[model samples]
Target: MEKFDNVVLNSRAKYGQFYTDPNVGRLLVSRIETAAPNSVIDLGAGLGSLSMAASKKWKSASIVSVELDNLSYFSSLKGNHFHIYADALDYDLPNKIKNEYGEFDVALCNPPYTRPLWKPEYEKILEEAGLSETRGVPKDGRAELLFLAQNLRLTKNGGELGVIVPSGIITGERSLDIRKKLLDNYCVGSVVDLPRGVFSNTEAKAHILFLKKSSPYKKNIKLYEVKKEGGV
Candidate 1:
């Protein structure tokens, strides 16, 4: 893993590819509420850490992993999971996955944290998800939110999602509409606050968001704070 990280370090800013810690990946997988999901996916899977963790937890489940980096994608192929070598934000990817694997039972991701130049395709995605009207729609794209929307689109009606996103999406005023969209359209299960430096290369505060792909319901969403790695 260290070797992989070193190889990508020089281009991390260009690709916005920061890998997730294995322990943190395990923690995110553990928080998913599903009892027995048969299919799992990791979009933006960097070296397959999150998908690898899912494989450990759900031994019988089939795993699908997608990565954009050439080296990372090839490295992930070492696992027994199906691997896709393409940009996760490609507009047609959801349909491709649907045709190939159908809607997944679970989706996990630790997406890139860069603010990319906005693309017209993103508007189409937000419209499809009924999030186009939200104030949280950024003129300059937010990669994490786009990844969240893609995860939702790829999941089954009663499926689960476990994703790591920047804390801004949880508390920023600009993200209010994104929060509202989640609360209004899905079953948010919990938000786990991870301490700084959880990722090897960045200090951006991050949170693990747990959601179920169903209409909003009246329930108390749990909140957890982890001061260090492995605390969850």
Candidate 2:
């Protein structure tokens, strides 16, 4: 049999995985205004770094981590979390989980960056979320956007979300539609731009998006920049 690390490396390549640094995960969790929640969900959870951080922070919260990569999912099994090995986008989150675990009070995600072709499922996802067809989200939207949309669907009204996304989604013209959709649906709590090389492996600059699901929309979004000291 192959070595454990070899299996993980292979899975990483197969899944386009980029595991979040523990420090980065902690930083993202720290952005949550409410430290204590009854239930939490971590989508595209890799190695359970963010999930672990959240468990520590929440103390009494039940965390469900959904991952697609087998090796990574297996690694998280030893942690204090409920692990689900499946594509979070397509996972059948049972109603029992929702009832027992409490309708997800918060969600944290560091979604994969892939350019998946648009599908009818994407439309179903949006329709389920009560979001109509909106401008800015292109037909050939990236997978990260799809993941974000799905996360929104999973989150309950008034729930909070902390996600790490590529900086382009905030600044790039191509992402304007999605951004518009996001601002329309969620109350923007804050956006923290991380320094380059934070990921160690990738050069892409990342932003931590802190948002809250709101009805009727809200104005004014907080923006911050994280420097070496980790302050906004």
Residue 137 miss distance in model 2 (angstroms): 4.2
- The root-mean-square deviation over C-alpha atoms between each candidate and the true structure, in angstroms, is 4.7, 6.0
What TM-score would you give candidate 2 relative to the actual structure?
Answer: 0.84
TM-score each candidate: 0.89, 0.84
Q: Candidate 1 — which pairs collide?
A: none
Q: Model 2, stretches more than 4 Å misplaced? A: 1-12, 73-80, 91-102, 130-138, 216-218
Candidate 1: C-alpha RMSD after superposition: 4.7
Q: Write the per-residue lDDT of candidate 2 for residues 27-61, one digit (tens) a residue.
A: 89988987578778998887788898888888778
Local accuracy by lDDT, each model: 0.80, 0.73
Please list all clashing residue pairs in model 2, or write none if there are none: 136-177, 137-177
User: Judged by TM-score, which candidate is best?
Assistant: 1
Q: Residue 228 in candidate 1 has what lDDT? A: 66
lDDT (tens digit, per residue) of candidate 1 on 123-185: 777777656767745577677778888887888898999989888778777778889888988
- Which one is best on lDDT? 1
